[model samples]
Target: MELFIRPNTNEINQVEIENETGTSDPVVVSINRILQQPDSSYFLEGIIYKVPEPLRSMNSEAYTPTAISIGPLHSGRKDLKANSLKPIYLRHFLNLAQLSVNTIVETVQTLEQRARYCYTEFIEMSRDEFVELLVFDACFVVMHLTSWQYPNLDTPNAVNLWQSWNEISHDLMLLENQLPFFLLQSLYDLFAPSQPLLEHQSFIQIVQYYFSEHKNPKLFFIDIKPLSVDDVKHFVDLVRMPNTRMYSHEKSDQRLLWPLNATELHECGVIFRSGDGIEFNDQGGCLQLPPIKIYDDFEKRVRNLIAYEQCHIGNELRNRVSNFAVFMQCLVQSDQDVKLLIEGGIIENYLGGINEITQLFNNLGKHIFIGINYYNSDCKKMKDYCMRRHHRWMTSLRRNYFSTPWLCASSIAAILLLALTLIQTILAVFTGFKERS
Candidate 1:
């Protein structure tokens, strides 16, 4: 058992509390009694009584960290001082802790070793950085908690490693589920209880930290397929951003990770091609990072983007039928994200309300939508697009209408001239006798 004394002010003398454990009874009782303070007064700096034997015993069974709790300080350091504190000001810190049971705060980090990426860095990090990284890494943890089939074996750091992984998984589930209400409120509710080791601990601070000062290197992944390294070089050449760093030959102990937050922001997947020459079909790098600190901005942006994306596809489908089918069919080529969204019921909402679609034909007799003027009207766009695309497949719905014949204005004028010429010949024949007389 170790007694770590903390002081209120810089004066080490006023913060002093001495340990006086008696030679009688067991060491555990003496350790606990001395920690209760001879003086009934509260000190901002807590003093502890050290006991080697029993102190190690209780903690060994739990495998949890030695709990250090922040005790009675009534003021928000910036708002209320010792003399100026009201009754409400006193319990603020405890209230704050109760609010923060589940939230995590950490900063942005690039991809590195998974254990080293999350574990070693989590320990070395400032409290703000730790929480920020924890927020996104939590998402990854939730995504793959049950699958501990990798390097997380029984090492000395196994306990800490599992705890980190478990907590991260728990936190991700929390964030995803609570996005509807005040995100900051949800953050405070989860993170309040954690002992404040670093200054930036709030959920808002975690987000602000990302966009303000956090940035990682650029990243792009490719599964080594039939595509040559020279092809990569050529592709990079077309992306002609001179300052953009390119590294084809970089290798790592774990997975390939760039030290940039790009992995944290984008939705990622692996790309591959199948052939006899292929050694591994599953190739390409994963962007392994968490979401950004966009706060409510994230939700708003997502809502707008999804809504716009759905409408854009609808419009394009309305304009071109075969193109739209080709698009859906082409998605079958690599149907991971797209298929998931479809299965998740995101697409059904768009086209389900309409009965059928309208179609137009191109000069080449290619089927398309005659919907250039349709936009100004209040029509169901998504269903319109889907039906127009599906119209050719429905052979039973054929009908011939009184359609217009192809005729130019000049052709109409020529027919009128022919009628006038016959009229003139008849009129001349009737007037023939009068002209001879």
Candidate 2:
């Protein structure tokens, strides 16, 4: 027996009525929606983006802001304790600048649309909402940064009074929890004139000084030329600016086929040296890497930076932060590799566990893609050096025969004895030939 199902009469009547009325097709509606969207060129202007899901899934905590939310993307999150303090900071900021709320709000309103375009996601808030968010958040940021410069000078009490400065700094550096640099610069320009300390310094200098003083100054400031406000997208971009100078612009078809980890490279006569940038010395067989001090927040910092590169830096050759992470991931495979790097002064492991450091690098590049890795040529050179038979033979000889003083003396004696025996044998053969003659 076969069973048949009848269509609902209401649906049939609705289709008949729709046909009679010449209702629009679903495809037409979709096309209309597409037509209503902003031009495709507008998307390229977006500098702030949500971290991609694949990367966020690997470590959600690394990308999510814990202490505060700066922009529209994370404004709805209620758990952020610092949200309550934003208003207090804003009030303090107004008092310090002697500007009324309307003045700041009006200033932010002027740039609201441009700031909204800076975000990759379509901000769901109204114009008033966005302008208010920027006013409050930008003021908070300005006050917070000012507090660092003048801790005792009756700045915003709520800036660092309740929240941990480290936590606040970490959240500020997150890619998702960012406002446009232009927005911050605008706010700074308005209020900075009134404040004696910030009057002389540019916004970029204040930002650079705040981060350098709070975090590692050597890592951020040493050998890094100051960047203009136009050069940075946000705090994450500012952090990444120093590394951009080291990226190789040349592209290569070569890929790192057999990447040797830290231990293997060390065994193959590749010396690891701590430097300010990632570079390979082909003649000296030295792999120079920037010294990284790994603390508790180091993974979060690095992961967000890599995420920023994935979203913002279109040219793979320019993704220096991501490339460095990839290079480190390839270099560090195990705890032993971490130990080797630490011994070479290339890594300052404040997190204490060698295994954790190894795991951090191994997982950093999990969902990341590199169209052109900047370190590919350097790795290829190292691989070629490792593959040479003479280098291997010399390394083996040094390890097996000349590793210790006793072994070196014994090997020397053995070589001398062999030489003497050979000379004597030759003399004996000569004498025998003479006798026969």
Best-fitting candidate, scored by TM-score: 2
Candidate 1 Cα errors over 4 Å, as ranges: 1-176, 179-198, 201-437
How high is the lDDT of residue 11 in model 2?
53
Off by over 4 Å in 2: 1-42, 152-160, 214-222, 253-258, 313-317, 404-437
Cα lDDT tens digits for candidate 1, 350-385: 322112101100111122223332111111222232
lDDT of 1: 0.26
Clashes of each: 31, 0
Q: For residues 353-397, write the lDDT of model 2, one tens digit per residue.
A: 788888899998788877767677777788888887777777789
* TM-score of model 1 vs. true structure: 0.17
Single out the weakest 10-residue window by summed lDDT for candidate 2.
1-10
lDDT of 2 at 378: 77
